[model samples]
Target: MSALPNTHEVLLRNLNLVEGRPALLGVSDAGLLPECPVPGLAMTEHAGLWQSLAGDTVWEGCYGYEPEPSQGGSYDTVVVFLPKARAEFELRLALARYLAAPGAVLLVIGEKKEGIAGAIKQFSAVAGDVVKVDSARHCQVWSGRNVDALSRFRLADWLDWSRVDCAGVELSVAGLPGVFSVGRLDDGTRLLLETLAESPLTADRVLDFACGAGVIGAWLHGFRRVSGGSPIRVDGIEVQAQAVFSARQTYLNAGVSGDIFAADGLAAIKESWPAVVSNPPFHSGVKTDTSMTEQFLSQVARHLAPGGELRLVANSFLPYEALIRRYVGPVEKLAQNRRFTVYRAVRKTLG
Candidate 1:
């Protein structure tokens, strides 16, 4: 009845593949709750859907751990929608093996332009064989069968969770496939760090808005930590479940304490704070969702402390400065590159 987001490939695959067959759906985007028009058998990770679907489900990403048994998921077939990241694809394949029952079928589908054909090489390692289905609308479908009698999801073997340094910031990160920045710091994030106006975070609690892998927060953890751990206790909020997990790992590895939660930006960040920094999330769920960044700015006025600062990075082409001015006091451009711009805003009483 309700509308669905841009992860239509999952929808299309579900419609084309599942025909009253019991199946388990492991998705990062919880928005898939509404699309189950006629639910036969599906377990979703998005928590909002669990109440309606009758299960104890939690919203989470593929890293960290696998979902527990619920309803038809036991002894049922599983289909994994390939994620955008190559590392994630590898991770999902391993998860799929764990989901497959004896003689269970694990089907995967993705867009042709996204290099699904190349993924066959990796899938073959886990599945005995990979079969291709029909292709339409620039998308391709592939199916793999797991015949392993003693099947266990190989999560540990797929990833190497280790401590690494990025630009002098040392932290431990479980950089799984499909996570933001894979195993290293993103260039945009580095640019944002450089652009952020140096405000002593030790004064008050800080916020790392849209923190991916907690790189900025990790770096700030050591910056001027007088006796206590950090001058400002950092909180990172990210929309992606996998991103938040990575951030948590980064925080733990860096010996920093920060809260990383999976929440829609405004709703998750509705609570007030004094200082905020970010490389605002621009890519929508499988689509371009500038509204999220736009909404974050529009609502930042209400949640921030008076005279608090908003520092962030975004593509230079985005019309965010005007949007920032609409909510906060003024926008100051600290730095610019070919593709992005870092902006600073201070909270001011609206006239």
Candidate 2:
């Protein structure tokens, strides 16, 4: 186990505000429940965090914005550990308000480096009369009243949609706050799609690993339709709840249907795919963490059907070539520019 995150540190210092049962949203797995005065509902959308807990306290692994109540009922206090995106912050604020009981308090805690100071302004908008309660370990805690709003949170209402041209077909994309490359296509994905367009893969099912907003999957569906190939099914796996919703909307908006659900990496995938295309996420929060992508590369081969292919795009600086060769099979560089490189690996079949 690692040291407690700074946000949890701030949470520990202000335990006095936790009146009645509380809801700890966006919680990490630092084993902090042992010290808390009351055992609150420890909730996190993150798959990694949700699975890391020891079941010492009540845990809720939510996949969507709306949080459900525990057996004890709605919370008297809702503690939100500020997310990495401002859009997500607002979403959490709205969600916290919806989850708390009448006259319940809302607490926001985060490190300064994670933009906790700027969030105080937004927190005040939803949680009126917000005040800084504590500042320690480079983290701050703010408390306020949870006021009911005029509007309810609909996940569709928060989506940011955009259109992109791929493989001679127009595709729609939907993204929520905190999702990677939301509202616009990123250059790396553009390069990967361009490469795929030059040589399309024919498969009944394709796995878009870490599929952010279903960009790659939607494009492939459109590409196949335009080329007069058999209709292809798209399977997307995303860890973030917002991205899962965004990807589902993206596929729906594109008039292409398949499955898009939340999962921590490939842990939930059982069926092998004929092809897997991804521009996998490289960052875990604000830091550049490639462990997820590396793990995907290491385990993806086993999840591929015989003669299946894995295609992905990544920054040129990252060392993924060795990992791919070591785990998947022989690798081939498909395309490259100054910033990104696309690679392909085919799973070997026994004679």
RMSD of each: 4.3, 2.5
Clashing pairs in 2: none
lDDT of 2 by residue, 237-290 (tens): 888777888888888888776898677888667878889888988887778999
Query: How many steric overlaps are in each model, in order?
Result: 4, 0
Highest TM-score: give the candidate number.
Answer: 2
lDDT of all predictions, in order shown? Answer: 0.63, 0.81
List residue ranges in candidate 1 displaced over 4 A.
1-21, 26-65, 69-73, 149-151, 154-169, 195-202, 226-230, 268-270, 284-289
Tens-place lDDT digits, model 1, residues 64-138: 334454321233455666566666676666656665566676676666666778887887777777777657656
- Tell me, by lDDT, which candidate is best: 2
Model 1 / residue 332 / CA error / Å: 1.0
| Model 1 per-residue lDDT at 33 | 40
Query: Alpha carbon lDDT of residue 144, candidate 2?
Result: 93
TM-score of each: 0.80, 0.92
The local distance difference test score of model 1 is 0.63
